[model samples]
Target: MRVNADFTKRVAVHFDRNDWIASPAAGVERKMLDRIGEEVARATTIVRFAPGSAFAAHTHDGGEEYLVLDGVFQDETGDFPAGSYVRNPPTSSHTPSAKEGATILVKLHQFDPEDRTEIRRSITGDSNLQLFKDSREDVRVLNLSPGEKLDLDAVDGLELFVIAGSVQESDEEFSVWDWLRLPPGARSTALAGAEGARIWIKSGHLSQMI
Candidate 1:
């Protein structure tokens, strides 16, 4: 199964709650944005857990990354509220659930084979611009007020995902969980909507494996 599988081309979409389809798990559902392979695959999705829902303990042979969008996500490690970002490197294992329910944006099997660092960050503070740096890439979250514009430099494989409100790229507008990916050497700027915008930006990734 594949959705937006072309790595050389740009793919974009707005996440719709109605598009969520229940997974094999009783109360867990997902809105798949891109995927390749069967049950165990390279994929990106927005997942939701109904109250009391839980997933069995499992190992990620490739890797896993996620950002909590709403409610709380819990595991043996601790409880993570909305605006939390977590990265479980290749071969990591965990049992994840939501007691109060939750919605999250997640990526599976997308890490470089040698990149095994574990990361967890809180994004619940006041809205602002922040960066997450790594030898392989730089990730940034921009919280922009109405009519605000943020300049983005050209880089190799730029990826943008609008988490909330609205953002404009060039003259194009995106809203509510829209996604976009650009190739190396691409340049651009983003502008916020009247209500403000919160966006996640990351770059310096191998496009072929995406």
Candidate 2:
């Protein structure tokens, strides 16, 4: 199955308008953002785990990257609370679970085959956090004050997810959990809404995939 699989077009998804679909694991559901295959697909998704639920042990042959949206995410490595960002490179193995329920925005099977970097971080407070950066992509979190303006120069490609609050791009408003993807060479700007906004952005990655 595919959802927003085009790499050359700009697309947006509003959280409130999407429905959650259950995964093979009980009590685990997902909101698929982009996909390119079936069960073992290269995909971007928001996954939610109900309390006491766990996923079977698995190996990340292609890699796994995620940011905890709420609650705590657990694995053999450690317990990650909200605001935590993690990357499990290719060949890593883990059994993920949530004791008190949790939600996460995750990307799968998108790493360079030779890449082996591992990162774990937590975004605390209002400061902007630079999650990761390399030749292929730049990933970060930005916190905006009410009425602030943000300029985006996505020369390679762009993907932005609203983590909290709202921001407007042209006439369109992106609120919490809203997602946007832009093709290579796109340049744009967004203005924060009355309550400001917190956004997670990744750029320069899509070009490598396409």
Candidate 3:
């Protein structure tokens, strides 16, 4: 059940080109990127929900994080449209579905026990973003133009997943569904494509490994 389970090595994979494997839920399919357990394992995957599809209520003992890639995702809280980022803390439960269908980049069972913050962000709203700079870190979640590079300080690491367009690191290229994880103290630059790019990035989290 281990796919790209090695933490020390750099891993990059294109999800759009991968096969869509059916999940246990009816009308739900997933493109597994990395997995390490059985049905309720620590895993990262790209999931798609067919129209009128829904999943049974379930609890995430280890937590869940997801970004809506296309269409809308629904739960008891509300509906999350494309470009939304959500995190459900440990021991949280929900029954998720989509009437018009949806696609999401989902990460499960990968959270620090002490990090108990729940977040839901809608990129469409202007108040959801802020620009700040400091001596140790520079953080922002907005538009990134082509050839623009972000330098994460040595104390932290960089993790980015492309929401749209394309991203290139070293010789590896990632499209919409691709993901990149740089190790601690690792230096990497991203170049967006002609269509520009939108990305979700998290820094200062390399030490917290699952």
Candidate 4:
């Protein structure tokens, strides 16, 4: 059940080229970026919930993190609109759904076993936002101006998702919702397009996992 499972290679997934696969839950679907395991696995994905759809209550034994891309995501704790970021560390439980449909980028089973801190916030209108940082990884969201260049170092592996606009790396261009992963020790640069770009980045984590 592995997709882009090689930790030593670079991988890129463009939004327009990937197909949505239906999830076990009704009216829910996912675009798997990387996966390693069965149902409950170490994975990165884009999930979409149809209106009135919900997933069964579940506990995250290995942790869960997500950023709402559109619409509203709701649970017993509260309702989260687009641009919201949430981290439910190990042992957290919740029933998640979207009353009006929603899209989110999520990472699962990727947290340190000792991490139990919870974070929930909105990142709207931010030029740059640091979501989290630990010895294992650094997570951030950045908004770029037109034709801007972003230098990235992958000393311990780096991953980025294009949330809006387009970015070019080497000879390849990434549009909205695209994802890219670089192996440890790699270095790359991304140049924004005419409309600029908004991206989420996570680095220094793969070495710990691999």
Candidate 5:
């Protein structure tokens, strides 16, 4: 029940290449990425809900983070449309359903017990992105053109996923749904392809023990 459970090694996968498997819920399918348990597992997956689909009420023991990739994702708490980022902290409960269908990237049980920050970001056009540069670190998330590179700090690691368009790192070409995890101190660079790129990039978690 473990996939990429080791913290020392890097794990990368192209979710688009994986087979879609049905979940227990009707009309809901998933592309499981990394999992570490049974039904209520610590997992990361891409879930697609057919129109009128619903999932029974459930509780997340650790936490849940999700980004709406397309359509609308809804729960008792609120409705999250495409481009929405959400985090339900540990010990949360909800019943999720979709009226017009939807797809989402979901991560479960990957939270730091003390890190209770919840975030919701809607990254549509006209959003003003703030950038900061220091001697040792530079962090930014905005419209990135081809050949633009981000240099993550040496103390932490970089995790990059191509949310839209394509990106090339070394000789590896990653399209939508492709994820790359770089180990601590790993030096890597990426370039957006012809269509340019919009990505969700996160760093500063390399020291976390899995």
Candidate 6:
């Protein structure tokens, strides 16, 4: 059950919201971008929880990072609305539900054991690009305007998810919910299109996975 499991190659791909398929969970679905192993796997996915749907409690042996795209997502911690970014470190457990529905971009089992910091952020903050991991600036979010470009210099690996607006790089035009991953030495300069773009970037972790 592997999808785009190669960690050594550079990949530049895009998927629309409608490209998703149903998940095993009733009232839920997924658009899987990358995966390794089975149910409990190293994966990156866009999960949509139907109204009044919930998932059973589960433990994150590796870690989990997620961003709410729309609607409200709830857990034991709190209710997270759109524009919320959250990270749950290794060994974290929770039961997730969305009373009104929600679409979220989530990454599972993708954190280093040493990276045990838990963070939650809302879009209301003035810090457009806030670093979740201290010192190295590995994981963060960015708010961009039309015609703006983010240069990637000496990045060993990179992952970008367009949360809003249209984003472009070379010939790839990405609207909301599009994700792109690049391996070591790959060029991934993101340029915003007409409506501008807000993106989540995970840099320097792919090539150095722990």
List model 3 lDDT by residue over 106-196, tens digit each. 9898776555668887665423253223332233464567766655342455557776778777867877878776766677677777776
Q: Which 10 residues in a row give candidate 2 its minimum summed lDDT?
A: 201-210
Candidate 1: stretches off by over 4 Å? 127-131, 152-154, 208-210
Kindly report which residue pairs in candidate 2 clash with one another: none
Error of 5 at 124 (Å): 1.7
For 1-210, candidate 1 gives per-residue lDDT tens digits of 998787666667767533888898889999887889877999988899999999999999889888999999988888989989998889999999999999998889987777778878887655664446666667778788999988766466777888788988867788987877776666778889999888888788644454
Error at 39, model 1, angstroms:
1.5
Displacement of residue 2 (Cα, Å) in model 3 is 0.8
Native-vs-model 2 lDDT? 0.92
Model 1 poorest ten-residue lDDT run: 124-133
TM-score per model over all chains: 0.89, 0.97, 0.85, 0.97, 0.86, 0.91
lDDT of 6 by residue, 1-210 (tens): 988888777555566544677876789888888888788999998899999998889999999989999899999999999988899999999999999999898999978777778988886443577657654447777888899988865266788887778888866888877878877777657789988887888877776642
Ten residues in sequence with the least summed lDDT for candidate 5: 130-139
The whole-model lDDT of each prediction reads 0.82, 0.92, 0.75, 0.93, 0.74, 0.81
TM-score of model 5 (CA atoms)? 0.86
Clashes of each: 0, 0, 0, 0, 0, 0
Question: Which candidate number maximizes lDDT?
Answer: 4
Per-residue lDDT for 1-210 in model 2, tens only?
Answer: 989988888889888898999999999999999999998899999999999999999998899999999999999999999989999999999999999999999999998877899999987679898888888889999999999999888789999999989999858999999999988888899899999999999998887656
By lDDT, the candidates rank as 4, 2, 1, 6, 3, 5
Clashes of 2: 0
Write the number of the candidate with greater lDDT, choosing between 2 and 5.
Answer: 2
Candidate 5 lDDT by residue in tens digits, 46-87: 899999999999887788878799999999878899988887
**Cα displacement (Å) at residue 92, model 2:** 0.8
